[model samples]
Target chain A: MAGHFKQKSKAKQDIPTASLPDIIFMLLIFFMVTTVLRETTVQVRTILPKAEALTKIDQKRLVTYLWIGPKKLPDNAIGETGVQIDDALVEDLSSVRSIMYRKLVEQPKLIVSLRVDGTSEMGILMDVQQELREAGTLRVNFSTKRDVVL
Target chain B: MPVIKKKERVEPFIPTASMADIAFLLLIFFLVTTTIDVDTGIGMVLPPKLEEDVIPPPIKERNVLKILVNEQGQVLLEDLPSAVGLVRDQVKKHVLNNGVDPRYAEATDKALVSIKTARETPYDAYIQVLDEVWMAYFEMWDSEARQLGYANYRDYVAVVGQDNPIREKIKAAISIAEPDAA
Candidate 1:
């Protein structure tokens, strides 16, 4: 009985944690290598409507821009009825469609941000939406000003 | 003496726990790295431009449908006060009778239609008209081939009418606008 107690061999128990950290590091590297980056390339020209609740977007290109102003004329913004692309006049909505398609094709994931005048007719805005869908550039955001909170 | 004393039982090593940890780590890694998209409500198609025989037609008022909506929300089909209920009927009639006028045919060749809207008219009216036009096109396409009136599938007016009458209607409706309305 005395020999049995004395013969007990307490083997060294130091399970290596180095292997775990090595694995965690490798996983971190793999994720960093495989991560995809998103770009912001606007498909249309839009002047976001003035809003009482607007916040500044951190970047461009992630957003598409559209400006709706006077249609058919030399471009009088005070009273306009059509869309603008990068500030140039688009006489008709079809122009908007084709241009958007081209942009969407180039940048597979681009969000369109609309800066619309509050007074713009809903019909025209809907028309813009209809065109966007046909072109497959669906991402949309509205530009607004931050309201003064009382 | 023969062989040896009974061999002690041998235990095989198992790595179940390690494999599970590795898998879980990989799963979390992928979930955090994917990109997502935002969507817009409407779609658009841009027209293709060609330089060849692109000619502007000598468009006159008779060939044009001339839809005008004044600031007061009165809808005008060809300069006449048109009600929302009357839009489909009037447009349908005009489209069906399109072949009656040669100039209406000619004006459409240039792809012009004058939708003159006042500064204050609601934009919804225009969208409604556009929606109707698309619906009418679908109807014309479906009815022309006798897909709806099949006996098992049979037809007498097979290919009698020309395709795209709506395009003609749009063209004719566009001519002769009040140039300054824009």
Candidate 2:
């Protein structure tokens, strides 16, 4: 009877799952390596408008962002829209040219991506464009959402 | 009596049962932290800033397609109140109207689309109009490319744009003036 039981156990082979942990570990390492943390926290409120003609930027490393919209909290109480480059709010408009020029020097193929609020006035938007042009950063993209067609 | 020495051997195994659990925890952490936001938008090349004002060559009124957006978000196509949806069609019509009529574009090469907006015009309206104008040119190029036996305008541009002078000239002909404040 004992020999019969051993024969039945041999016939019922277990599937080997020894390598599954190693595979999962490799996947975990890949995800950890490729993950990029969020860089800058947006200070101003921005609602990008939707548009039909949108071209995606291929190289993210070559692009820089500039945001324009109303300030947050008590600052908004002052009733002045603010322009932000990365983290800080720009007080003077002319300084935009110099700041962008410095960035252009670092990355020659720099593209200025303007994230302007939909409700914002065109005057400030155009001013930023003019500054970018002055800085020789002619490649500009107006960041917008993809228009949803039902 | 003889003195005997024995070899002490022990079996060892690294415990890996918890490895999968650790990996799963890490995977969950990455999944929670990952943000896959893709940046895309309408791109334009701004003309270089000029220190001195220079008079542009006089373009015939017939050859220029003027689009203006006022502060009230009303669109004016050649001083006529028009709907935003009509902008692309009107622009396409004006560009391809290469007829002998003096009031229309003499040819595609001579046509120019000029966009001007009021200072207080909403950015949304301005960008929408600009996007429509760009679409007009894009569609024209795409159709022209298809007629030339290419798959699409992007294919034509990629394969022929660099070495082909005609293709380059055709691309250069479709021009939009720098956006101005009304």
Candidate 3:
């Protein structure tokens, strides 16, 4: 019995860790491949509304976001509603047509995603739509969350 | 004279002990920064700018279901006061009427749901109304698909491409009328 106990105790106790780096490298490569670096920092406050009927935009490359919401002012004060395209807040509504037109020239199949805040009025959204219309970029999406039903 | 001893052999190999730590550091950085949230939304196609010479097609009033939403988020269905929840049933009835109800649409193809909102209408209110309209169409499609031996409309769509005849049979002809300039 003592000889059997001593033989059992001689078995390898530590787990083999030689492949640990390889495993970690595999995980690291996966993350690197799937990672989509966030390019633009959204300046406006866009709390999207919830809805039931929704569709997924699979092609992220084709989408250009147009944010319409109250401006995030200094000291957390909400300023007047504004339209933001990419990084810059649009100062002139008419200029939206030119910027979108230029983007359309680059990528003809561009889909303009309107990320409007729930509390915002429809006036600004309609104006953006008109500009989108003038730009000949007909495809648009209204970004909303999925409404969960109990 | 001193005898020269054999030089001690040293195994030339890269140290792999810290390799895992380095990879883990990078992995953690990416894991912390990466956000895989998929975007979900309602897709729409905006009408192109109309030319001055182009005359818009005129449709009969009975074929169109007008849903007007005011600034107060109050819904007016066909000029009648209606709630947001009632929109789905009403839209379904209007689309599937098929000449049975003179008050509703004449036929499925002739049916057009026009949603006109006020300039000051809340975005959520408008989305709610649009959502109801889309839900009604989706339910109709679901039933149609079930009749055709499919689980749901999405399944049917997956089997048959977007250009299927059923899509043409019960088309979602929703029109968003531009709000008058504020």
TM-score for chain B of each model, two decimals: 0.48, 0.75, 0.89
Clashing pairs in 3: none
Residue A91's lDDT in candidate 3: 98
Encode model 1's per-residue lDDT on A75-141: one tens digit a residue: 5334456566665666788777899888888887766766555456755665776677778776655
Q: For candidate 2, lDDT tens digit of each residue in B1-182?
A: 13332323434568878888988898889877875577889887787776678865678888878888899999999889999999989887877788765666778777778778777999999888988887877787788888889888888878876456444434433233455524
Off by over 4 Å in 1: A1-119, A122-150, B1-55, B98-113, B145-182
lDDT of 3 by residue, B25-124 (tens): 9999999887788789999999889897998899889899999999999999999999999999999999999989999999998999999998899999
1 or 3: which has the higher TM-score? 3
DockQ for every prediction shown? 0.07, 0.61, 0.77
Residue A40 Cα positional deviation in candidate 1, in Å, after optimal superposition: 5.9
Count of backbone collisions within predicted model 2: 0
Q: Order of candidates by TM-score, top first?
A: 3, 2, 1
Error of 3 at A46 (Å): 0.6
TM-score of chain B of 3: 0.89
Q: Give me candidate 3's TM-score against the actual structure.
A: 0.91
Shift in Å, residue B144, candidate 2: 1.8
Off by over 4 Å in 3: A1-15, B1-15, B180-182
Minimum summed lDDT over a 10-residue window in model 1 chain B is located at B39-48
